[model samples]
Target: MSLSLVLTLLGAIFLLLLFRYILTPLFLSPLAHIPAAHPTSVFTPLWISYHRRGGSQALPAITRAHSLYGPIIRLGPHELSVRSQSAIHKVYIEKGGFAKPKFWADEFMSYGVRNMVSMQGGIGSKEHAGRKRDLGNVYAKSVLLGSGVLSDVAARVLRGMDEVLERIVGEEDNADAEKTGSGVMEVYNFNGAVNADIASSYIYGTDGRTNFVGDVAKRNEYFEHHGTWLKGKHGHAESQKWLEEFGVQLCGPGVSALRDEEKGGADAVVYKQLHARGLRGNDMASETLDHFIAGAEAPRTTLTYLQWELSRNPTRQARLRTELRTLPLDPTTDIPNLKALDALPFLDAVLMETLRLYTPTPGPQHRITPPEGTTIHGIFIPGSTRISASLAILHHNAEVFPEPGVWRPERWGGGDKERESLEEMRKWFWVFSKGSRGCIGKDFTVIVMKLIVAKMYSKYETEVMEDGNMEQEDKFLAGPVGERLVLRFRAVK
Candidate 1:
C-alpha cells in the first residue's frame, strides 16, 4: 500500500476506535446511569479534563456533581465519585486492593520514576510501601518533636522576620522627614522563606542546610524553573511517552537539567550529607528532595492564609499572642519544652480550623477498584472502575461542620458536643489523607506550621497587605492562585 493510503487507513481506524471505546461508553454506556457534570460528560472526558486543567475549579465542580447525584456519581464509563466519608474510608482505607488511578501516575511520576507519593499498581505499591517502612521511624512524632526540628525552624523564621522588621524600621527612620501615614512595611516573602528553610533543614539536616531565607534570588529562580515542570508543559509529551515506556528513570531533558543543576549546587552538598548519614541512592535522596520541594509550597501558602486570618481577627490574634507570650522566650530554647506553648488550646483550635476551611489540595484521592468487586458506602462496586473522594466536599459537609464556611475555632473547644464534633472532624480530616498511602511528611508539615506561626506571633505584629489573597487555586495542591501573597510586619518588643 502507498504511504498516504496507509496514513488515511490509520486515521480512519483511530476515529472508529475513539468512537467505539471512548465516545459511546462516556455517552451511551450503562454507567451513564450516573449523573455527569455536563450533558457531554456522557460522551467525552473533556469536560472533566478541562476543569482539571483549570486548576482550583476541579474540586468544586466535582462537589457540585456529588451534590446533584448523591454519594455515588458516575463520572465516566469507568469512573465514579464517592462523596460520603464512610465511602471514602471504605474505598481508600479498608479495601487495600485499589491502586492509584492512571491519571495521577501519568501527571505526577517523573519519567516513570515511581516515588511512594506517585506510584501506582500492585507492584508499585509494594515497592513504595517497602521504601516508606524504611523511612517511617525517622518521621515519627516522637522523633519530629525531639529532634529539635521545630525549634530550629522557629529560630530561622524569627531570623527572617527580624530582617524584614529591620528593613522596615530602617525605611521608617530614613523617611521620617517625608513622614507618611503609619509607616507600613509589606512582608510578602517570609512565609515562603520560612517553609523552604524549615522543610529543607528537616530533609537535609541543619549541618547541610540551604538558605532559602537568605538566598532569595536563587530560590525564586528555582521556583520559576520548577513551576514550568509542575505545569507538565515543559517537554510534557516527551516525558509522558518516556514514562509510559521506561518508567521514572527516563528523565526528560528539562527535568534532567534541573537535577543536574541541583546536583551541582548547594543542594548537592545537602544530598551528600544525607548520604553520609547512611542515606544513599535515588529512593531516599530523590524522594526526600521531591517531598521537600513540593511540601514547602502548600504549608507556606497555608501559613500565609493563617496569618491573614489572624490579621483580620485581631482579637483572636491578640489571644494567640497572649498565649505565645506565656511560653519561655530564650533564643536557645525549644518550644516542645515549653508546656504552655504546647498546651495552648486556642492556637491548636485555630490551626485545626484553618486546616478544615482551607484544605491544601482539596482534590479527590483517585484510585482504581480491585479485580474483585468491593463494597463502598455499602454499595457494590466492580473491579477496574475508577473511584475518587474529595476532601474539600467532605470537610465542608454541613452535617459535620456547622456553618461550614465560617472560621470558628471556638467550636473546637466548648463541651462534649464540641469535642465530639472535633473528633469526628479529625476522623474525616483528609488533609494529610489516610491509610498506607497517606502523606509521609505529615508530622514534619505540622511541626513547621506550628513553629512558624508561633515564632511570627511571638516576635512581631502582622497585618494583611492590600494585595494578599487568601483564595487558593484548587489544583492537585491548593496554593495562592497567582502564587503571590503580601503582608505587613512590625516588630514588637
Candidate 2:
C-alpha cells in the first residue's frame, strides 16, 4: 500500500480505540440515564473530588442529588448514590452481591499496609469475615459482664479524669481566689479523658501489664504522626501502590508499629486470650486495635457535643445528673457494676439522642455491583456500577427524624406510638452501619461510652467553657470542631 493509505489506516485505528475506551464509557455507558451532580460528571472525577474536599458539604451535596434524581443518582461515569432506606437495605443487606468500592481503599491506604477496613479485591470479604469471627466473643455484651477488661479500663479512665480534673480545677480555683475571697470551683474534661482511657484500654488490654493509657507520650506521638500520614495529599494512593508492589507484610515503620502491637506485643495480650478461648480464624486483636485507632476521635467528639449541649441547657444537665444519682452508686467502691451502668435508661437516652444529632464519621458506605448484576429502586444496575448510601443524610431525614437537628432524648422515651417510631428510626440508624460489614467494636464502644458517662455524671457537674467551640468538625471522621474541647467541672458533693 502507498504511504498515504498506510497513514489513513493508522489514523482510523486510533479514532476507533479512543471512541471504544473513553467516549463510550463517558457518554454512552449504562449510567447515562441517571442525573449527574456536576456538568463533568459523565467525563471526570472532578465533581466527586470537589465534594470530598469540601468536608461538611459532601453529604449535603449527595443528598440534594438523590432528592433531585430519585434514590439512585449517577455520581460518575460508573457510580450511583442510593439514598432511600429500601435501596440501602437491598444493596447492603439482602443482596450481599456488592463489594466495598475502591474509594475506601484509596482513602485509608496506610504505609504499604491494608487492614481489614481498607483491603480491596476478592480476598477482602473472606479475610474480614475470618477476622471478625475470631474476636466476636471478646466484644459480646455477655462477655463484657464478667470481663476484667471492662473494670480495669474503667479504673484507668477514672485515674486519668482525676488528674485532668485536678489540674483544671486548681487553675480555676487560683484564678477565682485572686478575684474573690471565697468561691466555688469546677472543671470538665470528663468526656475527653474518659474516651481516651477507654480506647487505650481496649487496644492495649486491662492487665496494667501492657497499658497504652500509661504510655501517654507514645500515644500522642502515634496519633500525631499517623494523623499526618492520614492527610498527606498522595499518602493513601502512594501507600496503596506500594502495598501492591511490595507485599503487605512488609509495611513501613509507622504501620509496622501499629500492626506489631496488635499482633504479638503486650497490646495483643487481651486478643490472644480471646483467641485461646475458641475464637478461631479471626484476627480480633488487629481488628480491635484498628477499630480503636479509627474510632478514638469520635467518642471524644460526641462527648464534647454532649457537654456543650448540656452546658447550654442546665436544666437538662441537672435532670440527667438526677437520673444518674438515682441509680445506686457503690457505697464503698469507686466503680459501679457494668450491668447497672448499661441499664441506666436516661444515660442510654442521652447517648442515643446525641448519636442521632451528632453522628460521628457520618460518611457514605460504598459498594459495587457483582458480576451477576443487581436492581436497586426498581432500576436495573449493571455489574461494576458503584453504589453508595450516606448515613448523614439518612439520619437527618426529616420524615424519619422530625426536627432532626434538635437534641431531645425524651422523644425516644414516650408511649407506644412514639417509642415505635423511635425504634423504626433506630432500625435505619447507620451510625455503626449494619449487615455483615457492620462495626466489629460496637459492643466495646457502647460499654466504654456508658461507663464513662455513668462515672462522670455520678461524681461531677460539668459545663462548657465560654470560649470553647462546640460545633463538630466534619472530616474523614467527625471530631471536635476546634480540635480541643475545654469544659468546667465541679465535684458533685
Candidate 3:
C-alpha cells in the first residue's frame, strides 16, 4: 500500500532472517556449545571448505582443532569433525547409525552411476549388503585357500611375478658396470598392475581381465586416468567414461560362466551379481570400475609402503626372508598354501605394522548424524548433519599406539610377551574401518598383500632408490603424493 508500511514490513523480515540463519546458529542453536574450527564455521561452511581445498593441509588443521578444542568440533553450520573413540564407534557401529555423506557421490561415481561407495540410505544399504553377501563365501579365508578360482588367480599372479624377477635380474646384468639399479624397476606401477590384474581376474576371469603386468606402459596409462579421477583434475568425467568402458569390456559375454569367477556365475561374478541385484548395464560396469579403482590404489599403496619399510632395513629384510623361506613352497611354486603362508609371524607383523602407520586410505569417512542425534565426547550432535571421523586420528592416537608414526613391525607381536599391547592396538586399528557398512574387501586385500609380500621378499630384495613424496596424499583414497615409488629389486643369490 504505502511506502512507509512496505519499508516497515521489509525491515521486520530482514531481522527475522538474520536471527534464524546467523544469530541462532552462531549462539543459540543446539550446536552452539561445540567449539567452531573457525569463527565463521558457526554460520557457514566456507571456513572448512577452504581448508578442505587446501589439499594435504586439511587433516592436520582438523587435528589441530581437535587438539585445541576437545574431541568434537563444529566444522560448518551443518558439519562436525569427531575424533574420540566413543563417538567414532557410536557413529559407525551403532547398527548403521549414520548415512554416508554426499561427497561420496561427488568423488566416487563411475560413469555417473552409484557404486557401493557412492550409494546412500536404505536403498544403498540393501544394495551393499546384497553385493557383500554374494562375495562373502568367496572371500572367506578357507575359500580363498582351497577354492580353484583363487588358486588360479594366485597361479597367474605368481607367474607374473616370476616375469618381474627375470626382468629385474636382466636389467641389472644389462646396465653399465657402475649402475647396478640406475634404472630402478619402479615397481609401484607394476604392483598396481598386478593387483589390478588379480582383482579383475577374480571379478571377471584370467581370459577376461587385464594383462597389465605384461604391458607396463598400458598399466601406467590406466593409472594415469586414476590420477585424473582422484584429483578431480580436468577431464575426470571423460576419463570416468573410459574407465567404465574398460570395466564393461572386462565383464563381457561369458566372464561369469568361468568356474573361477563369482561363485554363482550370477551377472558374471561381480558384474553379473550387481546386475542381478538391479544395477543396470552401465551401473554394473560402474560398480566394477569402483572395484578396479579401489583395487588399483589402496592395495598398491600398501604394497609400495611395505616394500619401502623393508628396504630401509636389511636385517629386517633378512629376518622376513627367513620367515618366508619357512613356507612349505617357494615363490615359484604353483602357489603357497594360503593357510601356511598367512601364518608367518614376521611377515604378518611387518604387514600389520605398515598398515598401521602407513594406511593408504587414511582420510575422513563422512557420515551424516542419524535422526536420533548422538552424543560425541558428551556433546550432542543434531540429526541429518554431516559428521566424520578420520582414520588418521584413531590410528595415530599416541595413547593407543605409542610412537605411532614410526614403523616398527615388532610392535605387532604374536608372543605372550606382547599380546596385551597387541590387543589394545587392535581396538585402534581402523585401516579397513569397522561397522555394518565397513569394507567387505578387508580379507581379500590382506590376503593379496600377504601373498605379494611373501612372494617378493622370498625371491628378491628391494632397496628404495627414489620415493619422491612419500607422504600419503590427503584424499579419501590416498596414495603417495608424486604417484611414483622407485625401488631397485635385486635377485636373491
Question: What lDDT does each candidate get?
Answer: 0.64, 0.61, 0.75
Per-residue lDDT of 120-140 in model 1, one digit per residue for the tens?
A: 754236665666655656667
TM-score ranking, high to low: 3, 1, 2
Q: List pairs with backbone clashes in candidate 3.
A: 256-268, 267-272, 267-273, 268-272
Write candidate 2's Cα lDDT for 1-493 as tens digits.
Answer: 9999999999999999778767876667766667787767777767887887844437767877777767677777777787777887877777332577776665654443445677553323676566555555767778876776567666666666565455445555432122322222222233443565566455444432223233544445444544444444346455334323322221122233345655654433334544454532223333344555554656766766766677678777788788777677555446677787777776777888788788886767777787777776666778878788877777877787888888877767722244437667887678887776666667777778777776766676766545345565555676555555445666677
Please give the ranking of all candidate structures by lDDT, highest first, separated by commas: 3, 1, 2
The most accurate candidate by TM-score is 3
Q: Is 1 or 2 the stronger prediction by TM-score? A: 1
Which ten residues in a row are the worst by lDDT in model 2? 245-254
Q: Is candidate 1 or candidate 3 better by TM-score?
A: 3
